[model samples]
Target: MNDRLNLFQAARFGSPFGSPFGSPFGSPFGSPFDLAHQAGEYWLDAWQRSVLFMDAMRQRGDDHEEKLTQAAPHVLNFEFDVVMDGRDLARPVNYSLLRIHTPEGVVVDANRRPFIVFDPRAGHGPGIGGMKHDSEIGVVLRAGHPCYFVGFLPQPVHGQTIEDVCQAEARFIAKVAELHPDADGKPALIGNCQAGWQIMMTSALNPDLTGPLVLAGTPLSYWAGVRGKNPLRYLGGLLGGTWLTAFTGDLGCGIFDGANLVSNFESMNPANTWWKKEYKVYSEIDTEAERYLEFEKWWGNPVLLNAQEMQYIADNLFVGNRLSSGSIHDSAGRRIDLRNVKSPVVVFCSWGDDVTPPQQALGWVLDMYQDDDAMALSGQTIIYALHETIGHLGIFVSATVANKEHEEFTGAMDLIDVLPPGLYEAVFVEKTKDTVNAGLVDGNYVVRFERRFLDDVRALGGNDQEDERRFAAVARLSDVNLGLYRTFASPLVKAAINEQGAEWLRQLHPYRLRYKLFSSKSPLLFGIAGAAERVRAQRAPAKPDNVFTMLQEAWSRQVVGVLDQYRDLRDSAVERYFMNVYGSPVLQALVGLRADDGRVRQLGRDIARETVAASARAKLVEQAGVGGTPEAIIRALLYVLRAPELRAADERGYAMLRELRTHSEEGKVMSLAHFKDVVQQQAQILSWNEEAGFVALPLLLPPSSAEREHALDVVRQVAGAAGELEGEAAERMARIAAMFSAAVKLAG
Candidate 1:
């Protein structure tokens, strides 16, 4: 027994292949016989788990094949009918628009603004937006809004381009609007991940066709990231630009496999991709199989992109980073400016999203506008919501987010629509005992829009001027290398590969091959299915307290720790390498990167528009003493909250305002669009001349003392909805109340 104990300790602590952290076995703590028994049990349980895991993989492969056999395959939890197929359109693409069937108990209001969810075709196929019950589509449907989904087929239409896809999406939006002419507003557009940027481009091209736009986990400013953190941004610099992209397309016979993009994503987190994910399922095979298979159903099934579409994305957006700069032009040379998107745009991003960090997700705002004033001048209401800790996929997939953030956004769509043109951050604060008017708040949190500025966005980590220069150099080099590849290599490569060979290569890709090898198709895995069933019937999982089980878990953790360290070191090295190579003066010169080119590139402001805006501001100042209760109440609220800080506008306040407008004698005639115009006009008046605007506030109020008192009461309720006004806000409120009272008394 003593000898056996010694040997076990030696193997655990002293072996060269022991845990990455030095073992802590200086003395024996358990009976040798008991330890041996537990170890034997653990091994048996592990063997069962391994068989079950193999069975799960086989099932995943079977599902993949089944999905391949279907037309417009998706993982949406609800039933949907195809409304419009892009393949049937004049400019055919592989996308389709589907109207989701409402759940059994839910009733969708056709008169409510419709919602259209556009899923990302990044690497995986579509349906993630509506993959679960508590998802984007689910929330909209539950709220009685008619929901539509835009998804793509696994294969692209031949000779398709990104331009064709955008045009098709615009047509779909128009069709949805036409279908719901009685709807209160245009259909709200929701884009997730890669789809977010795509919809933005489409909206820019056809602004009038879209309504409010919601972008979840989208990366628009691709090059924007903190140094030493986002190594993927350095990929272009490390690879010497997009020549390899062209090479891959040529090898695909003019089609690019999305599996390559999925592989790149998997490579980002080696520990999760290689071990943690599989190990978790293996350990919890009894409970986790369904979820694991469901997720794999989407991740493993990669769609295809036309080579032209891929090249356009790689050149103009990813490496070029020109979308936000308004550098991309249509076939007719029409500039695609984000400012052209007239509807309110809401961006939902997360700090924990390594794939699309807050910097990349929100950096486009900074690129397009120099300041808050510039954004407001464009008459665009842009709202961004930042999550404290959620990954890229969780921004759309996580049920918790769908129920809370999405629910609040949808519930307050009208409030957002009527917001004055400015930069605002959507903050969802949890309600507690301290929350005032908690009953009035929706859900578990108080959803509020806090005004923000360009500087706030800059505070989030992003590329400095030096980083910009390096990225600029990378883009220029990519163009040159792409030209060289097209001239010398593409033709030869294309000639060497045909459709049949390309299909073979795709089937043999490592990501796809693993699934095929584990499935029933592989003779080696033929017996795993039956074996797993037998094991499941007679399962005997080891206790968590078992010594061997504890040791196994420790070892797994150690492995993850080691891989994380490696990833950190690798990312740091890549960042340094990119900076050293691209920052070189010679390389910059070779790539035609000028010294002054480090400045953030944006479209030159339209002189004609600027003149109009200037005249409009002057006109607003002249009409500072505007007419009626709506303008007076709005102007009063604006005056109290005009400081350079975040101002909270809660749903309860908007609800009260909405009720007031509906029942009030004077406000009943004001339409939402007309009310929005009044709000903006009053806001501009205050912005131009604060003192004069404040003095003129009472002049806009009704002469009747009772009417003036009621208007003041409405303003107080709306302003105090967030909380009791404090400090400057409190003083401003007092002054406005006093001014209103004095004006009423003088009129009497």
Candidate 2:
């Protein structure tokens, strides 16, 4: 065995197998082994390159610090006023009180429309949505809309419950509304990531205040995932449920470090965290590294949450899955039911987001509402968009995503608001320059979207109950464990902690300790400057195509693969162990001891019945002549079937229908009120048919333009053919031609 080991070692980096010089484990100044010499040389060269890279980074940091100090004089820094006096920094942005004061500000002189843009409070500091020229706030302001930001402080507010934070957001919205008495629409709410669900909860609780809501990269259904994939969903069960979170928060005397969350995110992609990101910086050290480091600085800085808040999130959201299940209730006995939210909900998720898998991000809709009928019964319009390959942060942070997904979404916000209360999928179809007509309102863009059915969303990721059931089991176990922990362990832990102990614990936190201790202020870093200069002067970077460099890259990849495999093994073992332990029938029986006293079940049944009744009433209204006439309906249906070549034509038709309906419902005096009402009612009825030309055109157009034109010609031919029939069918053909003429004029 010793001989074999010796031979292996020698083959790897000794004598003729190693490089002539600079080999990782070869003779100091002599030629290494010939056969595998390049491998040793590569390892040595990579090490040299890494040392030089570190030196470069230190120098760059020094330069950036100097530049930041110089630019401080020119930069305009804004201050925020904190509502709750806490250790954390919670500063609100100072914007014009009147909507008319800002370019994007819109105050419907008739009714104030309050708009809140809740930026994600992840590891990064606030202001991404409102920081730049072309941002969420900018977009809203450009449209003459009122905007408010929910910004948090650098530190967390002591004892701040997530509920308290939510309440504060609600108060802000209410205040904005009060300031503008005559706004036309309810306040439009936009939430990104962490803030997405936060706003959702606020909206669900105070449904009356919210209008259209956009939830980007927000994971409402946390436990929803596909097998083997979305390994992050299995983390809670793997880590012994929320016990570790409780322990950490206890150690900090109630503050749970946000750094831990950031760390978990980083761990998801070892390649990015350990190699790709840093290597990209080193490879493009002159410029790319600066931006990489700037982002890393924010990515590294994590915030804190109160123990109670973290505990609630873990039990109710992550593990318990109670939010979607309609089992969660606020302190005041108000059930935090997602189904109660009346406004249109826009869900933006991506397939590549491991942190918030597509399932976790959208599965809540399936969980809360069994089908489109249930969603319609609740008077909710839920539209979701699925991106093929953007990561969690990229969904909100990436410039490309901002330009495409966000831009298109903002433009279509009004269209989304008018969609009939039902479940629909927003599909973004790529369009070519040649396909775009010059007369269109939107500029030449490569993509356009159309609303689709829930089946399209289901097709993207199969909506199966079996995987969700496993998560449901996790949720059940979490409740029992949390109850036991609170009753038996929380008191003991709390008693052991004090202010000083909490401070010490925070200082000792793995994330905080690294930044606090290793910074330039640290005494040990006194010699870092001199050492960095020496390293910079002796820098030797590896050549991209060198045999030695290639070998080094291969070894690095192997190491990464091994690490990933080990992590997978560890995660698998942990999940299996916990699931087995917690999923035991004995434990389940103990947990089920406090099962609902039947009142909750009865109440749900009552609510469901009321919802069904209301839905039926709405359907009746739709069916009656009160909304529109039978002749008008036939006309609209024919127009929809015949006109298949228009751009954004379906949405435009829907918009026109919505406007007409709104005017008619308001009883507003207009010269063409009756005509508009008749046309809109017909449009609404036609919109219901999934097989309508407008509905199918977006999906069918790609086959071939000739085929599409042929389809359109066929519709016209059918109309002409219908003219040949006598009596009712002949009258229908005449109405169809009239409707087509009116629609074409409106579209034109």
Top-scoring candidate (lDDT): 1
Error of 2 at 731 (Å): 14
Residues 684-737, model 1: lDDT tens digits? 777678799898877778778898888889889988887788887888889989
After TM-score superposition, the amount by which residue 72's alpha carbon in candidate 1 deviates from its true location, in angstroms, is 1.5
For model 1, the stretches where C-alpha displacement exceeds 4 angstroms are 1-29, 596-600, 643-646, 663-669
Most TM-score-accurate candidate:
1
lDDT of 2 by residue, 1-748 (tens): 5543433443343344455533545544234454344555556555554554565455444533343234111111123333322222253221112222353234323243556777676655555565443556655555555556666654555566777777767776776667656665567788888889988899889988777898888988776666566777777776657877788888878777776777788787776776777776665554575566555444545556677778888877878767766778888998888877877898889888888877777877766755555555456777777889998877876767766677666666655654455565665545454442322334224233343545655665733543444455566666666667878998899998997988777667675554545445557455666665675576654445444444445566666778788767866775676557654656545546233222111114346657665665556433433322222332333444333332122333333333333323246633222443343334443444423423222322223444333333443443332123345544544555444444444444
Q: Lowest summed lDDT over 10 consecutive residues: which window, candidate 1?
A: 20-29
lDDT of 2 at 53: 57
- Residue 38 accuracy (lDDT) in model 2: 54
lDDT of each: 0.86, 0.58
